[model samples]
Each structure stands twice: as structure tokens, then as C-alpha cells.
Target: MKPDEIVVGVDAAWRRSGALDWGLHEARLRRRPLRAVHVVDESLRSDDFAPIRLDGQVVRPSPIPRNDRRLVDELEEYLAGADPALDLAADLMIGAPGHRLAERSASAGLTVVGRRGIGGFARLLIGSTSESAAVHGDGPVVVVPNGWQPAKHASAPIVVGVDDHDQNDAALEFAFEMAAVHHVPLWLVHAWEVPAPYTWNAPVANGMREQWEQAARQWLDTVAEQWHQKHPDVDLRHELRQSHPVVALLDAADATGTQLIVVGGRRHRLPGLMIGSVARGVLHHATVPIAVVHEHRATEPNPGQ
Candidate 1:
């Protein structure tokens, strides 16, 4: 666990171009070295490894030798051909891919992985892996979805989902820093929804809606003022919505062609709100990359679930 490194957990899949590029971009901006991680589950032998639909390269059958150097060679060879400018080296870990990567992310400044689909551990990072890393990792996890390409000087905005919670405010800081680094616009979102018990059968009053909206807007404005002073160079936009955080964020990202979505997740469970609520939903469907910042909390997810 190197403190100065950014980890990019990868598979033999070809869609890795996006995640790799993203990791490189962040590493360059953060001025950190990149550690390309590939975890192997001992149970799956070369005989068990097979080609999948998304992977462009046909994976060779796993060899009898379970040597780290062998995989490191493969990782380096692939990286050498892909992009030599990235200051990246490779590491081979023996364990469950998701679990190992989550632990690695705890010390990494950021961990980048593709939004993988369900399958064997060969891909290493499935949707579940990304979600787990985002929720449990001590740092931020960026899940790059398929078809997402990294732009060096992105003009598109970076969206941050902020709430009254301390964790959400942390996400705003990340969004501002990323936007400033890439010279892009920054969008802040604060979404509120009526409690199910309140909205289930009862008709909401116009006055109630107005009061809630006004209070939310005021809160957002106050929060934004502090960040604005800190990051005056970043083009900032803020919105308050009476919709689910997931819907408001995704819709905003799609409308603005946002480059990245930054959300906060508490390592410990918290009351009132959930840590992965908006982050998980967006990761499953977002076309853009999502950065889930891991913040610590003293609580847990909703007990009802």
C-alpha cells in the first residue's frame, strides 16, 4: 500500500482503455505514480479462464505456473503497447479480486476500475466490485463505464451530489478540484425527496413543497458560497431538485454531458440517509465516470432494509 500511488485494477478485457486512460489522467493531475493491479483467484486455473464478449483479446489458457512475474510481464507488455507515457507498474495479488482491490484502495489516493458486468473473477472488477470498493475503500473509487472516453482538457462539467451531510460536502471539494485541474465546469446538485410514509397515500400540499424547496435552496447556496471562495476559477453551477438523488444526478449528467459524477459514501453506516444510495444507482447506469469518495461515519445503512 504505497501512499503516493494511484491504483488501477484491471482485467484482460479490451474495454480497459477507458479506465486506464482515466487513471492515467488523474495520476498525471495528482502527480502520482500509477499501480496497475491484477488479482488472481487461485481456484480459477488457466483451464477455467475463457474469452468473453467485451474483451477484444483472446485470453491464453492460464499456465500451470502461478508466478507473479508471468502476469507482471503480461501487464507491462500490454501497457507498453497501450500508452507508455503513463508512469505505471503492475502488481499481481493472490486473493478474491474484489476483496483485494478494496483493501488496496484504502491506501491509494484513488482506485480506478471499469464498470464490469457479472462473470468470473478474470474480469476482476464487476459492478459489484466497484460498488464494494466505493463503499468500503478508504479513498475515492472511480468507476469508468463502458464507452466512456477520457478527455484531457474536458469542457464538459463535473457533477457532485451534495447533501446536508458532512460526507456530501466532501464530494463538493473533490468536484471542485477535478474541475479546476481539468479546466471544466462544475455542477452541484442537492436532491430531496418526500419520505415514503409521507408521500405514500397523502397528497402533498403546495405550501409544504415550497417550504422544502426554499430551505433546500438556501442550504445549498450557503454551502456553495464557501466552495466558491476557495475555487473561484472553476465554473460553478448549482441546482436544487425535488427528486430522487439518483434521478436528479443522472438526468443532470446526461443533460450536461458531464465528464464525471462525484458522490460521497461513508465507510460506516449512518442514520437518516444511506452512504451508497446515489453512488450505486449512478454507477449501474451512468455513461460517464463516477468517483465515490469514501468518508467515515459513525452509523450504518437503513436498518429497515
Candidate 2:
């Protein structure tokens, strides 16, 4: 497990070719190793099974084996087909899929997972495992949408959500690096809105909205300048929207034909509060690949902050 390796979750029950392809593309772009991890839940494998009543008849199911090499072999075959010359490794383990992936992400350069899996509901856009890895992982986790092919969007820009605070510095850094790697433009988006209380008064709401937009624009300008200085070769463009964060990000992606959307993910100590609302919303709604980076990983100070 190299620290700079890109870890991609390969689910045995789902079609993860998109994720594998995305991971391979990223690895080649960044010149990093690719690791495909397949985890089988330990709890799901039982040595003993109780008899169950099926159609008024007693039926006993066979015990599931704990160690399964078929998934690992399948993953290796997929990786070989994607790129035989690429640096790739495969890991087969027994544990909760999401939990193991999140743990692996603590030292990985990036973690990639499919938006949905076989266990996910048809209507659900994101699966529990992918959501868990994105929210609970220490580093950046990218959730690749179904049927996504990097070759189709080879020249698409990378979109990143910017906020007033420096919480999104890591996300910005990741987005800028991706943009530089792909030699495409980077769009910095900051969305603002007036408070609901002020909205009750039309005059106050209008004034507050104006003030917020001005402040947002100023902040975005400063951020864009700093990032430009750090990454002079990459093109930087910014936009300020008076709408929800998710909506603004999606709109920016749609308008720019963004291949990847980057946003900050916060890890909370409490359960159910692991992920921020904006990150969760974008994860569930965005059609393109989305990267959720944690702020704590931003070891270096953001310039012009």
C-alpha cells in the first residue's frame, strides 16, 4: 500500500468498470500506482445457518466462504484489459467494504468508488459504501458516476466549490492539481444567499443580497489569484451564484462540461453528522465524478488567505 497510490473500491456485485477506468486515468495523469480493493463483509459469511421457512417448507442455505479469490481475479482481469502497462495491484480482504476502504484511504493519494452498487436501490444515486468512504475517509474520495468514460470528456474543465472560509483549501488544491494534470481550465464557484429572516423584509433582503454577492466576488478573486500564482500554467475562472451550493456546483459543471467536481468534506465526531449537507447533496445529485477532500489534510497554508 503505497502512500501515493490511488485506491479504488472494486465491488464484486456491481459493474465497476467506470470506477476502474477513472482510477486508471487518474493514475496515469498523476503517474501514481493504482490499487483495486475488494472487500467481502465478514458478517455476511456464515459457517452455520439456521433453517428458514420458505413457502411453508424448512430450507437451510449453505454457508458462504470467507475467502473469495474470484472477485480479486475479476478485478485483475478488468485492470489488465483497461491498461496492461499500468502499475496496478489488487487486494482481497474480509471486512465491511466501506470501513476497509476508508481505513485504506488514510494514506492513499485518492480513493475512487462507483456512485451506486448492486445493493443500492434503483432510485438511489449513491450507494452506502461510496458515501461512507467519501465522508469517513481521511483523504480525497472521488465517486465516479455510472457509465462515465474519461475519454469522452478529455478536455472538460474541473469544477470546485469555494466558500468564504479556508475549509475548502484542500479541495481547491486537489482541483488545481487535477486541472494542471489534465491541462484543462479550473472553475472556482462560490454561492451565497440572504438569510431567511432578512428575506421577510424586501428592502433588507435586497441590500443583504447585494452585500453578500460583493463579498463573495471579492473572496473568489483573492482565492483565484492565490491559486493562479501556485499553478501558473493552469487556467483559472471563477463565478459567484446566489443559489444553493449543490445547485451552483451542478450548474457550473453543466455549463462548463466539467469532468470532475471538487468539494470539501468535513469529518464530525458524532454519528450521522459525518458529512456536510452540501457534500452529501452533491454526491447524491451530481452526474459527473465528485471529489470530497478533508480540510485537515491541507497541511500547507493557502496563499493570500
Candidate 3:
């Protein structure tokens, strides 16, 4: 199944169904055809065209019995049953699951993987696969956590964390798009760094905190000006904090009852091996869905400097 667009990344785990719904939602949002990919271990070395079922909570069962039960067939049947409006296709690939899916994400508008995958990627647990997508994938990566049901979170706002240390435009773009699509509000949160004063002057040290707090506001205002102008209808709100970015981000998401948290990684000098601390930190701690957008410009210096 080689159709040209794949916006959702999925595996064969039980969570695959949730991943499917996630992809469908994304397709509906972008108004494009949807593609679901299943990447098995290269050792299996076979393009799987076997039958499967989509109605059941699990994948390997006879819930929807039929002779021509290919993986994509089950998905197509499910999509058709679910909604005839979506244009969908699917395929199979044999490779290292995490890296292969991340590689596939290069051409996608966004790559979404489940909290847990199956096959080679699932062995090390979902963290490795989802983190690999967030850290190295070319486009933005959305990690749907366990028990992620859209019905429950449809009304929640989208939260984005920004700082001067890394690029924030990509995050803002994603957040605004999500807000616009769901007709929800967007929360723009900025958490500044608190470097300790080098000297023993307590008075001067106390002044530094105030200066940094002021800087955080300026950073939020600058980014907000550009983003809010483009999305005039979005209910945009901002927060400035002197606490750790990760803690602030998680807390803000919780306080605002947000369903998704969007963050950005700084451009790595080596390109494939590194990611920013804030993005990595929130990935492990946030209870809601997480989307990590990579820095768009390699030459753009960290604005925090």
C-alpha cells in the first residue's frame, strides 16, 4: 500500500486501535487521505497481507471474521464502518520499528505513535519508540498515551511550552493549528531559567530574579505577537514562570485541563543523537498527550542567548 501520504505512525500492539483513531482524527483535521503503517522486524522478512479484526479491543482475534482479512482491509472496514468520509490506506514494512517509523515520518505532516508498540520496537517498551520519534523524526511527533480517548479530551485546551533557549515557532504553529481545528483555547507558557549569582552580593542576586522574570515576559510577548496575529480568533493566553520549565509546563497543562502539550527541541549540532532537556523531561512526566516539534532552522541560534 504505497499511496503518498502517511500522517500517522502505528504498531501492532493492543494500543494500535487508539493509534488508528488518532490518525483518523488527524486526517479529519488536515482534510487529507490517511495512511496507517505497520513496521515488523526485518527478520520476519515478509510483507504481511494476513487478515485481522478492528472491532475487538485486541488485534489478533476473530471478532470480524472474513476470508480476505488483510491488515489494511480490517482498517478500511473499520474506517468505513466508523465514517465513510475518510479516505484511508495502509501498508506493511519490515525493519527496526522505531527508527523505521521515525524515518518514515520525514515526509508526513505529523507522525503519531502509540504509547506502546509491538514487534522489535515494543520489546524495549513504548518509551524508546515514542522518544525516538520525538527526538529524531523530521516532522512533529505526537505520542498518544495509554487510555487516550478523544471523547474524554475533546474539550480540553492545547498547551505549548516556550523558552528562549530553543525555537518556539514550530510549537506555536502546532498549538495554534490544534486550537483552530478543535475550536479550543491555546495556552502559551514560558518558563525562564534561574542562574545562580556568581557573587555573594545577596541584594544583587535578588535583583537578578526580577530581571529574569521580566525577560520571560518579553520573550512571551514577542512570540505571542507573531502567533496571535496569524490566529486572531484563537483564545490565546500566556504564562511567565521562574520555575523549571518542565514542572511549569506539566503544572500548567494540569491546571488548564489540557489534553495535549506541545514542545520544541533545539537543533542538535550532530542532528540525530540529541534533544533538548525540556522536551525530554515533559515526555516522561506529562499525563496528557505530548507533541514534540523539531527546530526548523539549523542556523537559528538559541534565542535565550
- Superposed on all Cα atoms, the candidates' RMSDs to the truth, in angstroms, are 8.1, 6.6, 8.3
Query: What is the full ranking by lDDT, best candidate first?
Result: 2, 1, 3
Q: Write the per-residue lDDT of candidate 2 for residues 31-78, one digit (tens) a residue.
A: 788999887776676665788999999976654453357778777777
Q: After best superposition, candidate 3 residue 152: deviation in angstroms?
A: 1.6
Tell me which residue pairs clash in candidate 2. Answer: none
- lDDT for each candidate structure: 0.73, 0.83, 0.72
Please list all clashing residue pairs in model 1, or write none if there are none. Answer: 46-62, 269-299, 269-300, 270-299, 270-300
Residue-by-residue lDDT tens digits, candidate 1, 112-178: 8877733546444346666666656666778887556676326788999887755565577678888
Query: Candidate 2, TM-score vs. the true structure?
Result: 0.88
For the record, the alpha-carbon RMSD of candidate 2 to the native fold, in angstroms, is 6.6
lDDT per residue for candidate 3 within 41-75, as digits (tens), equals 55443444455776764343223222223655665
Candidate 1's clash total is: 5
Pick out the ten consecutive residues of candidate 2 with the lowest summed lDDT. 295-304
| Candidate 3 Cα lDDT to native | 0.72
Residue 38 of model 3, lDDT score: 64
